[model samples]
Target: MAAEIRTFTCLTDNFGYLIHDPATKATASVDAPEAGPIIRALEREGWTLTDILITHHHGDHVGGVAELKQRYGCRVVAPHDKSTKIANVDLRVVNADVIKVGSLLARVVETPGHTLDHVSYVFDAEKVVFAADTLFSIGCGRVFEGNYPMMWDSLLKLRALPDDFRLYCGHEYTASNVKFALTVEPDNPALKARAEEVARLRAENKPTVPTLLGDEKKANVFLRADEPSVAARLHMKGADPAQIFGELRERKNKS
Candidate 1:
């Protein structure tokens, strides 16, 4: 049988996700922004939480972990980086680690940038990627704990995923991301089309998570630093991709 995934809003702009594997009757929360909504989702699905897979130590992402774990006695999986300082960890994982939530399997990919301890989870069989702060639908996270080149490398790692993978980010920043993206690639037809789509989704007070990786690659300017047109638009022709990426990130920070 197929696993079920549920997504809901939490803590203002944060997103909370629950994935349940019916075969083993196991359920895991991608990140816990808060407890109420996650509990509600579990109640609605009638699935018991067995694990909490943390992408990073950010408060908004981990705020509900302790409460939920105490309530369910769920196992908490976290990053291998000790500097992240996440408490209540049952297992600490690094890149290429295989984590199990009953019969469901997730591969870890270290994607430090926003934070050196940040990680992304990929359920390849399910074709889903929980990238958290590393990547967004039309943008990427600001490089806070790591340098621009490190962040660029992290973005490249995600961009290398299969184009068909579904991307689940940490927030609802699509509309604003699209607006900033336009200034970078004003003439991109794909971006222009996606802007209209994002506008409609936001107008209805809907969430725009779980977008296709392929769509993001085409429309997300942050992933297009290597594109000649993008470089030309930024007036940085024939530049190193990392340098171009750095420039784009600097502009986004200011935008």
Candidate 2:
């Protein structure tokens, strides 16, 4: 009676997740970066495509919607703000909206920064989040649609979630991101242990996502803006937390 979530790497780095509810043999794809892998997974699991959830309008995230929708005639769900760009959306949802995958419920979290129309789905009942590009494993998405302050605000909202919440980010860039993190906190023991573990995982070409929020808070500098050590490293000069986060984002963009 166990529900399973299967992830397939699409494009070069993007991830496409399929949450399978065995009880109903229903599946939902978090983002459709590509159709080939997703189509294959559906066949492999003998699951019906119940829904397609889009986090943002980015091409890498929604490029396969039309094809997949036509293939399975699945219901498409997207953020209400980007309904215009999301083709054939069945339900335009807003923040706090709850949707179901069989019996499990997932709440929509309006997290904008990487994109103004961005949203992340939080499966609070399962302690899992489909964070898209808002919050990565060790690094966040580069600011493209919003500024430092907006991104900082968005990140703060996510940081406030329960420590045990597991983050399922959009990309498989943990190894490189960990390398950049070391430049910011070279002496952090947590970062050191995680880096070694990430190296081993990447060496075997394994995915390094779905990290716990508490672990990211300790090792990821972007999630550590409130800490004195990160503040000093970013040379906040006694500025507020928002200002410090802004500075670090700018530095990373240039780094």
* TM-score (C-alpha) between model 2 and the true structure: 0.96
lDDT of 1 by residue, 1-255 (tens): 777899899999988999899999999999898989999999988999999999999899999988998999999999998777676899999999999988989999999989999999999999999999999999999888898888889999999999999999999999889999999888888899999988888889889888999999999999988999988998999999889989988888898
State TM-scores per candidate. Answer: 0.98, 0.96
Q: Quick one: best TM-score, which candidate?
A: 1
Error of 2 at 137 (Å): 0.6
Q: Please name the candidate that would achieve the greatest lDDT relative to the true structure.
A: 1
